[model samples]
Target: MNRWMRPLVWAALLGTSVAGAQGIELLPGTPRPLDIRAASPCTFVTVMNRGTTPATLEGEWVNGVNSVPVAFDAPAVPMCEAAGTALTPIQPQRARTVRVKVNSAALGTLLGRRSVLEGHLVLRAAQGGPAILTPLAVEKPSLLGRTGVQRLLWPFVLACLFILGVALRVRRALGQEMFAAEWAPEKSWGSNLALITGLITTVGGVTKIAESVTPLVTLTGVVFTLLGLAAPLLYRATLHSLAAHPDRQAGPVWGYLLASLLTLWGAFGGLITLGALLDSLANRLSGTSDDLLGTLVMVLTFLIVLAVIVFSWQRLVQNIDEQLVAAPKRHRQSALL
Candidate 1:
């Protein structure tokens, strides 16, 4: 996908797409719920009752953070010939202009720690059919708000956390296969240094790339991140014990077995999917950028990731014996020198 359009595709993948309501459709898309501030809480929206029977609308504003002392109003007001009528049911094929108002008093009640007093106003027919959910946010500009540090840097920070999670999971999965293969573990300070350095570089590079694509401006991203860290830790700690006692090495055939293939596939596949979900969340904020080519290039790197996955699987399955033999050959060559 083109960088210009890839994010839209990813968004569709990550975002929860609400199906079109069979009996209700909302209108006046301007001043979207999240885009409007508390200073302008009252918005007039038109809601059409598409069903054959007349139906009244019921709605509630669900708070996203601190208990903002307010109620979101969605009342069917008068419209057309005479003037808009007060909160009433709409006849078949008729529409009503709803006075969707949020009490501005919420700004006072919010704890200083929270940045936004956000919520969604869900409108559904009292008779019941399908409902429409409109997400809204009232930003506390002095804090995180829609711009500033939260929009520019927070996404990258979240992305780093997500990368760390995926890397740890990959390490755990590789350790499992290596243990079965009885692959020699290099017990030295070099291994620790290389691991730490690689992690730092990887996170730093990714964060820089995300920073280049700042100001995505979103609240939906919150639903996406976390996990892949807790899961790998929960796995049995067999690799550590195996590394400690190299004398009881398992046969190379163990790594080539069908169970070993399944093990690697399961770990890589599931954790990678989890990683994408978190990554999309990072994108959900920094998802948009002016430089399309850079965005495109960043996405193309997934090809490299897929290459690594394939190589890791092949390293164990296709040439297990060869890999094992080469390791000892290298060890002997080094010892002779």
Candidate 2:
């Protein structure tokens, strides 16, 4: 992905000589300087080309001396670190939305404290002509403001309650006569481990999002982030154990098929999560380098799991009619003869 970035693109966008109107205007009325906020941080200002000529509007976010980071993967917006962000040529009298992202962390660092970004969006014209300087300001609200606590607590609380409900249901199911021989509470080590690790990861994720609170929160996030890396594997093991239980032999083909589907879903989670974790770790360790190892691993895992799901489903379908036919013929054939 880094190879896609050329130094020339950055130079061309950032090195424009002059600054003026440039025949393009911010639509829905020009935004007030201090009215802009970073709580939502992403602003979608419509750029209208009032001139007869088709014009290109490229955005460069800068705080006089420093550049703010723009996330390229933001939905509905196209941004690149090298080329900056640009909109398609708007013909005369046409409008298009231009997304401007303010980096709060960079803003904080610039001001030497937690604060919002007060910057300008440098909109450049074709052939390195004059630029339109649009003022931008960010607003950083308090950490505990407006449903902040609710957002943190509800998802975590609901997830925990759901997990507890599942544990109780499993316990009840195991006590039933049909599943008594198949499920042993003593042998549920894999499920237990997944439960513990998943809960820790969930808690860590919640607190990590609320990281402005304390150093302990950040440390918890780092520790569980590493520990959570094993979740997919443990989850897979639990699903595999449940699906391959001896009692499944007595159930219908649909039941087995459902188990196979569950197994496939579990495998997907395991493979994708593991690959993401590996990619993140590799990126952190390597620093400014990129590789395809994680992608390759994920692709291979997908193919293997897909094949397993397909084969199992096909086998189940083939056996369905055979089982149905044999059932009626067992005692009826003797009676008819």
Q: After superposition, how far is residue 228 of candidate 2 from its true place, in Å?
A: 17
State in Å the error of residue 157, model 2.
Answer: 25
Cα lDDT, model 2, residue 164:
43
Candidate 2 weakest ten by summed lDDT: 328-337
lDDT of 1 by residue, 297-326 (tens): 335435644554554544433333233332
Instruction: Name the runs in model 2 displaced over 4 angstroms.
Output: 1-99, 102-129, 132-250, 318-337
TM-score of 2: 0.33
Task: Show the colliding residue pairs in model 2.
Answer: 37-139, 38-139
Off by over 4 Å in 1: 1-19, 33-40, 66-85, 105-107, 113-115, 141-337
Model 1: residue 186 alpha-carbon error in angstroms:
70
